[model samples]
Target: MADAVALRQALAAFLGDTQYRKFVARGMYRGRMAYWQEQEWTRFTTAHPEFAVDLNELAAALLVCHLHGDELKPDTAEVFHGCMDLARWYVEARSRLFPYAAQDVISTEGRPFEGDRIGVLFCPACRVARAGWRRR
Candidate 1:
């Protein structure tokens, strides 16, 4: 998996242009990312007003790192995977209390080419492409 630094760089590249870098340098990305991410939660919260506990943020962090493999510390791959496992656990455990957007699990735009497959989540679209992984 990519290390934190690499992931950050990838994120910068993904966002494209120098604007993202400038934004991060100014700490604006952090706030924007947080706000947008909160939007994801807010949609769920409205339906489940009692929902207040969650740790998907950690999974998201690791996912971003894993997807940006070239940047994450090479050795941290396992750590990132571990975090994903826990994140899955958290999602499943809390599903009964707070409904999760199924589409969120499987990516919609497909995985990034520069992304690491080692610990990346398979989106439904990807599944359609690889449905014949072991065709007889």
Candidate 2:
């Protein structure tokens, strides 16, 4: 199959399954509205290897659509753009919220001290740090 079709199929499979779709939607709707890092994307797809190729290709295409050809290439950008408003909502909602209270839990050995870990936070689809702190 052509690369685009294969990638789309992969993405469709990922999106067709409720759980996998929810995870991608969460990342796209949550976190920052920026392109995800290669490491992060690989990590996420590794957790769902069945859709690894599709996710990687789809994500790359979405980045291209998002960055260029937004005006004259609306159709090409629809999939990624579909998540823009939701991302905006996440950004705004998190911005209006309050910061979480600092905890005194025992630190894990060798783990970086970057304040709180993203796992404990109410993460959006992006999986990166949110724009601000907010109570869940």
Candidate 3:
């Protein structure tokens, strides 16, 4: 069975089911929407019960498709990590710029959120990067 122990251990060079599932969740709050899939949402939520990310296009497309070509690119891991870095800035900036009145305030509006247009994320692809722009 692929568990925490198995995931920490990297015997194979290829991206395994366990690893891919985790990656789905990581880019989730960060970026790498191009790699996300609806099916993987379950695994992501299960693996990271502590996180309370909403399953929305905005969260999914937090980062633009900075990546090009194959899903299993040699530097794919780095790209995922890159999202992790952006996540921090996102939180801080959101607080100052968006300044959610409440935790749920972030949800009041939808993607293409009314914030600064900075490509702090991967590609500023989604509605932000996903949409080819960036949220504050």
Cα lDDT tens digits, model 2, 36-73, are 43454576467656545544445443431111112111
Candidate 1 residue-wise lDDT, 1-136, digit = tens:
2243444454455455454433332332433445644554455446444433334332333332122122122221111211223377645533332221122233324434343333433233322323333241
Q: What TM-score would candidate 2 get against the native?
A: 0.22
lDDT of 3 by residue, 45-110 (tens): 466544325545334332222222112211111112111233677667544433211211123123
Any idea how many clashes model 2 has? 5
**Native RMSD of candidate 1 (Å):** 17.9
Question: Considering only N, C-alpha and C atoms within 3 Å, which residue pairs clash in candidate 2?
Answer: 26-125, 27-125, 27-126, 30-124, 30-125
Show model 1 residue runs off by greater than 4 Å: 1-33, 57-117, 130-136
RMSD of 2: 15.7
Candidate 3 weakest lDDT stretch, 10 residues: 73-82
Candidate 2: regions farther than 4 A off: 11-16, 27-57, 60-136
Q: Candidate 2: deviation at residue 52, Å?
A: 6.3
